[model samples]
Target chain A: MSSADFGALKHPFVLRALEPSDYRKGYLKLLEQLTKVGEISEEEFTARVEETRHLGDLHHAVVIEDVERLAIVASATLLVELKFIRKCGKAGHIEDVVVDSTVRGQHLGQRIVDHLTELAKQLGCYKVILDCTEANVPFYEKCGFGLKERQMARYFS
Target chain B: MSSADFGALKHPFVLRALEPSDYRKGYLKLLEQLTKVGEISEEEFTARVEETRHLGDLHHAVVIEDVERLAIVASATLLVELKFIRKCGKAGHIEDVVVDSTVRGQHLGQRIVDHLTELAKQLGCYKVILDCTEANVPFYEKCGFGLKERQMARYFS
Candidate 1:
């Protein structure tokens, strides 16, 4: 199904990219709901915004905002990458997906991921991928992604 | 161990980033050694270079060169990323690792990954990640990368 068919918020909530003003405050509340729980001070937020602004457009941080409430409710990022092996030569990796704990079960997470998946297709990516815990597999499957491979990592000091 | 102690190629082989001239011919040779097994033409390689050059320093296309033979003998790319959860606020993703089939046993792949891991550390990344097939797991383990997690993926058409 097209992204439009994917369930989206109604009424006063809107889904869009974060603005400069969001860097000062508000996003931290929504960020706390992600798998990583924390409070990011405004200074760090501001720095990250500038660093990303300079890095250009490959990183898209999609935010679900409650227009009337003036708060971010849900969010995810689509990281597009150029590749050497894919038949289409590009790939999109979605990361840090989350829905506000207070707003779970509303299907906002599905809408946000669907939007990014459509964007990835439009950008000619051979694949749109994300790594989620086994518990979250069913959620991604709901968003039209099928489970395929395993993930590996190494942490450094 | 420091990146310098990472067992680099001996004799006339040197490791470094790909040069502009590499887009014309030698990269295809080096690419063949990667598990993907294919030839990338000059036009495609040039276009990809232009596309990613705008992505800035994150994509380090490190290559092993033979000063005496004047050819790229091995190659790999390290993609560094910023994050919200890590203590260091960044991550390193290694991709497209290749070691010339002719020079495969010399530990060129190990040095290339080691260099990128150190580069990632210097860039303040808290972890380094890469997805390889089950067969290649032992090779990455030799480079100080242990099996920690499974990498799951979903492919889109």
Candidate 2:
């Protein structure tokens, strides 16, 4: 019922579907951290937080909260896209899995992934894929994600 | 100078900044791909695309298009977040570098990344980070990404 209730569970952590209202809090947390460290101009940070809340709504975004802490410790989303490989197939691309640094070592990360993987399967994804930095390869591999042979790009100007 | 002009280059790939006007086209592309292949329901796909496009805008999305094809070959964004190390730094989290499958193996993918990397540098990002499956390790490495550490996570439901 409460954010702390969610985090205090004994088993690894439980996942929850994020509601529209959660965005403001999550964005503010991110903004607070950014501002405390002076990584963004206050103007830029405010604008980004507002914009990100809108985007989070669009992604069917979900969060893994530390129920005890009443904080969103980790989050991930399935970016479902259609593909015509040989024949049409549904693809689920997982993106944006962020875990709070304070809770990094408690196996909470693996729990969050397990939850997302199940969601992907239920969605009937022919393939559930995610990208991670080189450092994170072993973790995903441990989660059962194999290497995909594709080049990725982004156009930011 | 114009979206049409961007659509006119020989090989004519144009990398444009994401705007509110472009959200519809971007969302449509994501929905059509995911829905046609059955990754998500029409309703879910539409909703998710809208959220992602909005997020993309907040992060300063960019798109690469093949003018003649009138198709988005690739897209990516830079999420400006603060790092929490002793020497906290501003970092760029690169997200969703997707290139249409039909155009895979062309250097378009690399070009898109190059553009964004430059942008990250200009934006004063100490480092630009992205994630990919093990399969993409070599490709990203070839593009100059060094191995960091493995990231792991679990989903709780």
In order of the candidates, what TM-score does chain B achieve?
Answer: 0.82, 0.69
Error of 2 at A142 (Å): 11
Q: Worst lDDT window (10 residues) for model 1 chain B?
A: B1-10
lDDT of 2 by residue, A40-130 (tens): 3446545443543443322344577655556666666554443322123445556556777777777666666666576665655566666
Q: For model 1 chain A, where is the 10-residue window of minimal lDDT?
A: A1-10
Across B76-154, the per-residue lDDT of candidate 2 in tens digits comes to 6655543322133445666556677776787666666666676666665677767666777777777777665443333
The DockQ assigned to candidate 1 is 0.44
The candidate scoring highest on lDDT is 1
Q: Write the per-residue lDDT of candidate 1 for residues B92-131, one digit (tens) a residue.
A: 8888888778877777888888888888887667888887
